[model samples]
Target: MINNNSVTFIMAGRRQRRRRWLLVTGLLTALACILCCFMLLLGNTIYPVNEVLRALSGEQINGVSFAINTIRLPRMLTGLIAGFAFGIAGNTFQTMLRNPLASPDVIGITAGSSAAAVFCILILHTSGAIVSIASVIAGLITVLLIYIFSRGCTFSIGRLILIGIGIQAMLNALISYLLLVGAQQDIPAALRWLSGSLNGSQMDELPPLAITVLLFAPIVILLGKHLSMLELGEQSAISLGVNTDMTRITLIVSAVCMIALATATTGPIAFVAFLSGPIAKRLVGAGFSNALPAGLVGINLVLGADLIGQFAFDVRYPVGIITGILGAPYLIFLLIRMNRKGDL
Candidate 1:
């Protein structure tokens, strides 16, 4: 009962989809690159591109050298790496759980990191590496707790999501309580971090995050085929020879580490994680792995929003504020649509 015409049409459609994915992915990469350049070149002094390049090359372009090498380069690198981590990790959770609301931002993971970082800053009187280390550890523990609780009868994605939201609320309340009880002088630093600013990014803070991403991003991508199968639901994925438990565990740990490291570096840059996956999904369409594309979208969002925050208004805003402004409306729309479809 097979027909050549139908087969031909399907092949053509597949080819077209591939083309679209390539085009969109390439465009996203180009935009991210442009934004990175702008981050380096358009600070208070506005160094030219050639000057930035020369400074990066260690040629020392007078005033441009310090600003470019010390401030802008670190900031740009932080945003780039952190954005990719958030994007890829977010997409992994969303795709694996088959729910947009499963993002770490919505599901308590970032809250775990934030809570730990805040504790370090306010209670322990810590500043640098201690806060980052505590954040990563706390994030991992949070995921483990969520998994254990959600596995009562069987692993249910809905149950995991609900529990994550509940945990997020509890952690947020804890954060508030800590803020209230902490020293008044430490409050400003904690608040600035909670707002997710890149105001004082430094080169020394980049290594752990950069190294984690370099090691884990490929693991996530290499597992992308299995991830797509997970979208077919657990039973179907098992039938298709996917090691659902191992795959999910690998993905969750890898993503959490990446995102937690990012949170450690950038203080949870709002919804770059939440927004990147859906945007990449929309841009790339179906049948292609979205992990890389989502990362690229995240890079663009962070860099673009940072630029907008810096220059678009009289007073500068953090990247999180701008991304929150962009993501909130989309979240509202998605909730409404999901409600109508009975998918909420």
Candidate 2:
């Protein structure tokens, strides 16, 4: 009963699992610290970590406290929350669809939000909570449309993505039409939204978004075991007593909510959703799921992009543009590699 080879194999497996866990924990901690540092250094008034800490502790140093406490803190926190939510949500969709390219931004949810927000901004002259509500509704509608359109075939991932691409094109065209038709004075706001700026995200917008993400992310993570179990193909999963359709619908709705909330706050940050999961899987050696690590990577990506956009260039650009600049090439590389492996 006590075979040496079996004991060694068990020991090796435990070691590998332990190592992966340690790596994930370490990466999460490091990325959080890095994001904190970036937030401290980002704005025009650069404050050192010590000063930022003192500010958090309610100490003022040359108005650095005000700058950090009042302005940069809210912006940075919003970015972190939005990025983390989008990342986890994106990976969940990808895992659900069993395709790396499946993400909320890719699958029309973000585009839907953008179109709704653009309409509100250009035509209704609505700002504040109305826009967020409309955007979330549009996002849900888009998700429902995708489901209805693909209901005939039991929903293939390929068809879903193709449908999403079509929807995205139409939404973009509508946004273009709105921008072209709107007054010159309002074009700035519409264009700012289209370009995905976090510039004016105030303290008020942060609280609800932060609460939503905090409340839902753990729920999604708790369902991670079911997600992974369902990933073993639908028939196999069904055989294992999983309610495949219900599971898929639940995950899809949860993921869409996360993306909608994030897009409402940050105006659809680019590529952090598309990039985080794969980067996390590669970093953590790919055995267990990468949901949490993907979320961490997302936070790092958004924080890093915001820092670069804020300080690296002479003119400050939106973080989304910076992410587009940095992430496009990485995406291209991933495509090329996938093509080489015949996965494209």
Candidate 3:
């Protein structure tokens, strides 16, 4: 009788979980649809929803097919990919470190990519694929360097964060130096790139990003299952038959690759990486979940931010700047709240 009661409780719990999952999934889907409509409606000349739908379906409306297909579509796609990448990557790292602030942007990866790309732009006269390559190299190298420097009896999150901040400071100085020495004509372009604009992303840049995310996101999601296991602490995970070292490394490498690819395309975007995971966790009612909700939330974040950037302000700003504007305060609030709770 007791065993039967336990089984009944388990079944009931599973049903509850399924219900919650469905509800969250439904909300996410609804948000995505709303964002898509907003994206179609918000740009200059403000197409009504009906006309935008027609244009998207390859039907002409207001002679705007060219503009919609060539310009708006690419921009919208870029936002979607960048946001999704940032969100998933951010959550992965945070979950790995078991800390909220442990995002790629916070940990020097983005700064590294930004620094290398800026240097290439200012000195090497590189553009396009070459710059993308440089960003990936810089990001990977920065993380590897951090790992090397921090290796001792074991890795410490505090050490990793401090080292990353140091790296960020160094990269920022280099950026300042480049701007000082750079020609006036190139300065504006460099600044725009640094500010993380989707202004110039062409459809050509889309394939690599799309393919990278498509190939790697599933791996990350699968690997993310080990996260809650890993979070039981390394020794505990090992005791539970989890290959802690391999799992950690693979998860980190996969996530870094996604971030590098995304950053290479869109210039490290801003807080999308840092913000997505927590938002998703809150939305999904926390505890321990993997990458799916975070990735979806990421898509929502970028799309929502881009729409606002394009239309919310009097003058257009890059999605990066808008995210920074929004994310920084939230980060500070998080920090303060953590401190108050003695988690800091």
Using lDDT as the measure, the top candidate is 1
Model 3 / residue 300 / CA error / Å: 1.4
Preferred candidate (lDDT higher): 1 or 2: 1
lDDT of each: 0.92, 0.80, 0.81
Name the Cα RMSD for model 2.
2.3
Best first by TM-score, ranked: 1, 3, 2
By lDDT, the better pick of 1 and 3 is 1
TM-score of 1: 0.96
Error of 1 at 275 (Å): 0.5
Winner by TM-score between candidate 3 and candidate 2 = 3
Error of 3 at 35 (Å): 1.0
Ordered by lDDT, highest first, the candidates read 1, 3, 2
Specify the poorest-scoring 10-residue window by lDDT in model 3. Answer: 282-291
Clashes of each: 0, 0, 0
Clashes of 1: 0
Estimate, for each residue in 253-344, the C-alpha lDDT of model 1 and write its tens digit: 89999998899888978889999999999999998899999999999999999999999999999999999999999889988998899886
Q: After superposition, how far is residue 281 of candidate 3 from its true place, in Å?
A: 0.9
Q: What value does the lDDT take at residue 61 in candidate 1?
A: 72
What is candidate 1's CA lDDT for residue 313? Answer: 98
